[model samples]
Target: SRFAYVRDFELPDRLLPGTFILLRIDGHAFKQFTDAHRFAKPNDPRGLELMDHAAISLMREFPDIILGFGQSDEYSFLFRKSAALYNRRQSKITSILSTFFTASYVMHWKTYFPDTPLRYVPSFDARVVLYPGIREVRDYFSWRQTDTHVNNLYNTAFWALIHQGGQSKKDAHESLRVRFAWPLL
Candidate 1:
């Protein structure tokens, strides 16, 4: 029982009460994973479906998660302000959600990619952010949605230039750069 004193060394990570909690989980090094798996460019329906399935599973497991938004290799789960899950422990909430989501993804991978074999395990990293009110939450999700749209548009144009127009990768990038005059990812 003497060793129990070490628990005092653990830092406090309790989230603020009466504030919305958002947990965002993002794929770790998914570019390499996608390349190794030969996921379709621009958009992979199977991959998206797998993510959606995993999110749904997470929601079912944690009913306190009121909303989920996902795009590409990332997902955000919002918990109600009054939720008492884990007593609002930040580490517990983030770790559990990310781990559960990852497990669900792996568990259901075969269903989505029936013909393909998983070469390696995939991982996701998660962080918890608190919003003071509904306005901040709305703005946060709005930003994510806009980011998805912009990135999707860029990817579609870039891939089309290379795959359809037969332009080299460098040429396609240069074309988009010169035409858009905006920084690309």
Candidate 2:
């Protein structure tokens, strides 16, 4: 029954009625998004225009999502379901399964964003949680953490994320140079 790993803390309840998706875009893209916002004059309409441009770009590729991007060294998404989505379970994954994913995101974000941390939300605050989905993720994490073998898969996964996830492959790989791989499965 356990299909995925989830953080033990807070998460959204009820899968978003519309398809919910999470994005992990390059850090540079996130920076551009924020920089444009910061440079905008106080209450400038250009700020909104900039946002509109960015949103259009993101949606041209990921059409159907109705929410804004949530960035913290990476991108996350929350949107209502649209019929055109290919991943029907995306809503469930982000609102619920994403708890575990955030542990990874927050950990990575901390390497740089220690000054500002991502807040953990409780499941009670979720808008549309169902009992069965909760049981599924809990079971998955239980089995994963309890596994007798410590393959250090988590560590490897993190390294891979940074190494392969960046725009400059060399720069991204450099991020791992001083760091030793320590898988804490």
Number of the top lDDT candidate: 1
What total of clashing residue pairs does each candidate reach? 0, 11
| Model 1 per-residue lDDT tens digits across residues 73-111 | 999999998988999988899888899999999999999
Q: What is the C-alpha lDDT of each candidate?
A: 0.92, 0.39
- Residue 50 deviation, candidate 1, in Å? 0.3
For candidate 1, what is the TM-score? Answer: 0.93
Q: Show model 1 residue runs off by greater than 4 Å.
A: 178-185
State the displacement of the C-alpha of residue 167, model 2, in Å, after optimal TM-score superposition.
47
CA lDDT, candidate 2, residue 179: 54
**For candidate 2, lDDT tens digit of each residue in 114-135?**
4444343211112222223435
